[model samples]
Target: MPDAARPSPNCQSSHNAADPILVPGRTCWRMEKADRVAVIIDAAAYFARIKAAILNARHTVMLIGWDFDTRIKLEPDDPMPGVPNELGDFLSWIVRVRPELTINVLKWDLAILKMPFRGGTPLVLLDWISSRRLRFRLDSAHPPGACHHQKIAIIDDALAFCGGIDMTTDRWDTPDHRDGDPRRVRPNGEAYGPFHDVTTAVDGAAARALGELARERWHRATGEMLIPPPPVPAFWPDDLEPDFRDLPVAIARTDPMADHEGTQKTGKRGVREIEALYLAAIAAARDFIYLESQYFASQKIVGAIIDRLSEPDGPEVVVINPERTPAWVEEESMGSARSLLLQRLHETVANPRFRILAPVTEGGEGIYVHAKVLVVDDRLLRVGSSNINNRSQGLDTECDLAIECAPGERPEVCRSIRSVRTRLMAEHLGVSVEEVERTEEATGSLTATVDRLIRPAGRSLRPLEPQPLTETERRLVEERLLDPDRPEPMAATILRGATVFGDVNRTAWRIGAGVAAAAVVGVGLALLARRNGLGKKMQGE
Candidate 1:
């Protein structure tokens, strides 16, 4: 058997600062075991793998997400033939054919209320309710401003995927992230921007852990106890190649400390497991840390990075982020915050060891980097839904899976980690993995390796140039709505971040946001009322 298939060799964990093994409760929620693990790079690969996994499910499939769109195609271009390709049709068709199979879907309640605007039809959603076996629930289990943000799918408790990719529209793009790919079109006939994301697939114990998490969430939202389906003998997807086998994969979570009214829930210490892991991983780095995330507005994380960079022999830090934020308020908040953080990181670090970049297609079109991944010193690999934003660190409910090759041991695993990082770099650079490997060997620095592979044209990663924020934007940064340290109400956050925005009259912009927040609550309540009415009408029928 190949070295990748062997059990990861264990190294004695030390609490010593100089050499610490990430511990349970300190750096993570639980250090569970996995029979095999594979890191899927993009949604194009992930969606197909999910389709296959669901097809192979013998008993149950559970999907938990921030949003769910029934229209997205599981296998868009070359769909699975015998059954329909759309996610709803495919799932329902399979269950119809195999009556014993059942699928449970849970999505954030507010997100569900907005689904109609995104092109979901009532008839189709009604189809979901038509099947008693297809249990669908909208989750409203969190404090104000907090979201049930985990994206997870567990099949028969044997295979599971956890990461940033939502099984929804505008999420299926290839590594190339081309601007004009026909498969990138939405159900509404308009093409969306190219997207980039990732997820980790694990079998056996790791899958069971995620399944357990999903069930706990189900109980919290709907008061239904979900039972784990009997384990299946074998169900790994055929196309995927495992990156590591029989590895100890750690699962971590973030649950809001407050209740619906934003008041602190007594005795509920906020789950900061993911945050602890972030700091520990940054502290553990010996050479480099490569990160790709959707948002980067967490001050605590930035402080940790600065601390590491302050070291005389600090490791290089390379970050990949989208050039422009997707939402306007996000730009006002995280975008502004990023500029401030970059400036501090640039001025405070001893040397120019910190670097950030945004990915662009070979045609020079920007491709969004929505993947949440971190690799440190060719030993630690983390892939999941946790972003570097404040909400992901502690406010919203989240799940992240991570694995590490122990310090001073497991050269094979070390090489594998390096290989995964190299491949990712190569994908962004539009070069072969061999080229990345050669560059790494020559330079021994991630920054230098990336600089070497940058081309004049075509797919490549470009340096992220921070933009100057206006005085108003800077004040908003202090308000922390976009980069709130905790999940709280928008109006309160905005008012506070103001010590913090009128670049239009910035006051007008601020007021507009406040009004919008009110409108959203008003909309949420209206929809909630409508949902209740629908429930009553259905009962009568």
Candidate 2:
């Protein structure tokens, strides 16, 4: 693997502070009250909020996502009189009901193209674009081989949602994550894994900024300018009431433009912003660092945490991921890398203050972890589209909101955020928050919880046992590592090279060959256009 030490221009001097000193009573930042922010805990809440925003939109609706399934129902069981249940039907109804309103949708072109069986069906969206006042486009051209992986929705420039959640089937789940709940429906009647995710809703200036982001995406996708939507009426759902008012929120966004011109200047890769933000938050942490992410494969971050753990006064670090990667490739590539990284960290920290956990229901259905959140010292909080993985930081465009809590302000808001994380841990361990807290208080940190549940009798720490991989799984993992665009190319190349000729080798070879062929085709097309009159025309010669 590449020496995880590539000099990052985004790296700043770490502020090795012990804990965040509470700022005096509710120091209101220059942000507006209408510019409030609320964290949506799971996919269900995310979709419900988007549905509400769309329904309440007075002038415009804009959406951008890495993946979107029109077949997915926004309101699975809500008996609302006029609400459309499924996404496609709901969108169509919105156009029909509000003919004058403009709506735009943009999705990653590759993701759309991946579903070849649905060929020309995107024409349905194109037709909607043509027939109604709606506009739909597919975005493909980002940094070469990179993806536009942001998920956002802006309604009439009055409300916006930004996060890791995608509006696809199998994503909706309540916080309860009840085992084998018949109420949860999979499109093909196949049972899906339990999952968790988070998104943010913001109004006021921050909302308008998100609208700008949607407009920028639309322009990149279609070369068409988007006009800002007119202001809309306050339509906050009764269920989404603010946990605390007058909270100070910071709207932090990531884009290629910033990389190309901003202070960090990590080139077309926006991972630097995500990394810098994470490291800065880590240094700023005082009490503890609580995070929930789909994957953990960044060794640099693990190193940083190890450094912190070496400090006697450092805050605790907690991570939640699925027990195993869902696919063979992930298991081999990210799963193995994470396993090794965690072991290294564990070895460095004598007491093992850091932890990685997976949530499971009583019935043994593995929770598909997808939430992207960070709570630092109970003062700094973030919820957004980026994961902790390498792809999210470097190869994909992501956006997140980071907020600093005002001292003596609604401390309950901070408590609420902590409660959510603790509650998740409780669900996984089948223990109560009070119990976890009591144990932590007695033992000094989360290590006690892990030691109690995971360790064998008379053992202080559990042995670093790797998940078993089948031959097919091993081959898939090898292939993922060989891919340069993946997060850990060095590890992938080494591991995959060793098993590239095994029984599962053909499958890996085919996939690699396909990606290479696509890259050739893309480059050939670009060169041909440049040589012909097409490029000149595109350049407006």
Candidate 3:
């Protein structure tokens, strides 16, 4: 991975930070100071840091994600002599080495259906059951159509990770994003495409706050309230340097709750802090806004962007997304929605300063972007598991970490955020960090810099032109058939689908559509859980 040089401590930007964008109760759940925070750019670096942190755990380690594949290799490129490379073996080995340490793994209950196909995972789970120190559980606390989508890890209440990268197969890829890297293969020895992702690591009170969140989730899923581990010295990786030091990190969440019956529910009520933060951040932008997400189909977010673009002096905007959703069903749903939204943006803006682009490797293979990140002109930085999709807004569970800079405060935080944006652009454009910074300085626009730097051949950022959607696709997107904004009862969902297709109920194809809708609500919940290729069967490899 190429390291972007941090700005000098004395360096500052002309655009002084604006008023705080991360507001408690409105934009975030809480704010806590982190002793150190590092943004791990991709899964390879994140996996390595996680391995080191977990190994340093003195008491408890919690793994929470949409899916978990014990067969996936950690640090495959740089394995330690005599140390386990696969995740399951490593966890077992760590517990045995540190008798005081107890590790717990929690994954969405729907993912259990994929366990049989995952190499050696069944045996690994059996082995985990045999060890008293290692425990695994499935999370089914969500409503029928919703799934637990937060990818998080907490170690000893000292260090924590929260973001889009899951500790599962096909997620490990270096920043270089080499198109044919042999290491980018599954445990079954099948190769996958280049992948891009982002996550943040924090140590201090911030980590402890995340620990509380993780514990709450575990309690909700299993009805087992685990006590917080005693606070200990920070166990951040020795070699890793934090992007921001002694900064306040805000925690944002999306927890959907079903309509209650006559009695009160023990679980917490639904919160839409993530959506609020996105809106607040967008509304707060002055110079520019940069976003990278798995899907760009959120109507609320698109409307926010359109509102900004309609302004005479609105900030320039840039987005990074995959060339196309990897799965066919996802393509028809989220993909079509993305197309519709992009079309609206193009139509609404007269002088377009916004550009949505997809990253590709030197060999021209699309790099699957699974990172959910938002940076608003160095005033705020958000990195987490929530995508710009309806499900993430209020239907599914999510968690995001954000750092905000008040006007004339924390020059270092501002510089760090700028550095992260440049680093991401540099990676996508196949250029050096210095080159990106220089171009941005000259163009005075991130989108313009992208336009100036984009190439026709080698690794480049290609503008994503909206595809023409068929009548069916348009209806699917407009009706929000597959991506409802809130927790929906299964019966209501089916009936709604039936009503939508009732006109053609006699047609054989319409019957197939009904079955597809049923499947999406049933087993298809797994596919909707995460768009990072973990949900469905691999098409070829």
Candidate 4:
């Protein structure tokens, strides 16, 4: 980690030729200085640190995510005796005790469908109605079939967290990720599989910038402008250790251009800073690129990787993904897209310069890899909610925090970047950090080190072999109906009609229109399947 005492004048200077990849308005929204920054691995540590920071918040607490369940306990394994353990109860208790504090939560509106199943969430929200300071709003300010997928939390505009870990059920898991851990259970006591995720926490100017971003999102969703809270003392967790200090963090976003009901749309064009950042970062890799994402189905990203591998001295690439999505529908769509991309990679790259792997438990159960992280050599590190998928590139609302280590500047930052990679590799391989470092030093190749460490048994990274795609699956991947890179024009047209036309039976009309649209899409897909003989294959003919 970089020393706190070291001065970073070059990073603090105005944007110029020093910073290349994190250019504002192109690859990022803004660049701001951070007093301290830490990459919180897994939800266990993330939840605990967030709880601590919120407790210290004096004015505001903003929680934005794809989903939020008040039923889940923040620290199920290690609970405090007097303090509230459940998330809803914890927030409620804070507002009541503080009196002057306000808590605002914004979640994807579609996630409300699951609220009835989330025990105590409705009751908790009902209780919150008594206090005007505690507010909850659903975010539907997105295009049809798009979602607000960024997970973020801001505390008094002094500290903020942005990343893939959502404050919901089945996300809490320690780095150990032991098989059948009793603590890995839902609020209803049902055991869930081990999950791996990451989030970055920052303080100072970067946190303030994130706060502005969160406020903007809230205004768009609820049509209520929020003022920034007065600057407060640092709320850094007592037990947490920062990975970098005195560094400049770039904020990148992916926001689709869509018209909301009550708010003025920003413009015709959408923000694709996240996509630009990914392409530039991938192209700038010198030695290797290490990626950890939930899915690998983006055509642009895959094309960039292919371009790099085609180079004679291109950087080696290593990707980690889940063996397959847990849900059947996602497995068929995203999983099939992955298989096709992998086949293309294999066919184009002559030498073995790239590999995709999945993490496994000691019992050989596949651990879900939900962390969206990218590390290019030892110069750049990105951690956030953006996944390597088509939707994340341009359709979904996403945010990612990136830090770059310029050549001949801040060697400590470079070391910290390298440490992040080694630490993650150690956790996945079930080995100590020292062991990973030693092996990598001995081998002098990241891919070679991984190949040497992975064994036939115990917890290890298993190389994922792409499944042979059937004709139906191949058509699905090529069509990309499930993972379109932009808003579906048909769906958008229907939405605009519902908004522009007034009717007494507005709800019914909207529902009927949605059904008609779905039917049209479904019929087209059915025809495709029939043409491919999928119907007969499914019927066992």
TM-scores for all predictions: 0.90, 0.79, 0.90, 0.87
TM-score of 1: 0.90
Give lDDT tens digits, candidate 2, residues 1-541.
2334222334322564533322211111123334466777777777877887787778988888887777677867673576778787788788888877777777776565443344344556646545436655566546555667788888888777888888876799877777776647765566677777778887777677777767766765566666786666656655786543455455444454343222234334432456666766766666677777877766555556666666777777777777776775556567766665565565556645676666666665667788888887667777787776666655567777666665566677777666655655565566677876677668765656655655232212223344554454444433434223333333444455555544546655664566567666665554543344221222431
- Candidate 3, residue 13: how far the Cα is off, in Å: 22
Clashing pairs in 2: 1-490, 19-286, 271-393, 481-492
Each candidate's number of clashing pairs is 9, 4, 0, 0
Task: Using lDDT, rank the candidates from best to worst.
Answer: 3, 4, 1, 2
lDDT of 3: 0.82
Q: Please write out the lDDT profile of model 4 over residues 1-541, one tens digit for every residue.
A: 0111122222221223245877888888889999999999999999889988888889999999999889888998788788899999899898989999999888876666576787668778656534468877666667766778999999999999999999999899999999999989999999999899999999999999999888888877766779999878776989999999998999998888632221236665678888888888877876798999999988778777777777777778999999999976577668988988887777667548898999999999999999999998878899999988888988899989999998878899999999998999999998989999999999999899999999899999999987997655665566565676777677664554444333435433444455466556645544553344322222221
| Range of the 10 consecutive residues with the lowest summed lDDT in candidate 3 | 1-10
lDDT of 1 by residue, 1-541 (tens): 1111111132111123346445777677677788788989999999999998888988999999988788888777788768788887787788888889989888776675556576555567666655578767667767666778899999999999999999888898888777699989888888999898999899888798888888877766666677779868967888899998876888877777533222346556677778888878877787888999987777777777776677767789999999988877778778877887776666666357877989899789889998999999887888889888777887788889988888766677778888888888988889999999988889988988888888878899888876887767666555555545565665675565443332457554675577467558845764674475322223422
Candidate 4 or 1, higher lDDT: 4
Candidate 3: misplaced stretches above 4 Å? Answer: 1-18, 258-269, 503-541
| Model 1 spans > 4 angstroms off | 1-20, 257-266, 488-504, 507-515, 522-541
**lDDT (CA) per prediction:** 0.77, 0.63, 0.82, 0.81
Q: Please tell me which model should have the higher TM-score, number 3 or number 4.
A: 3
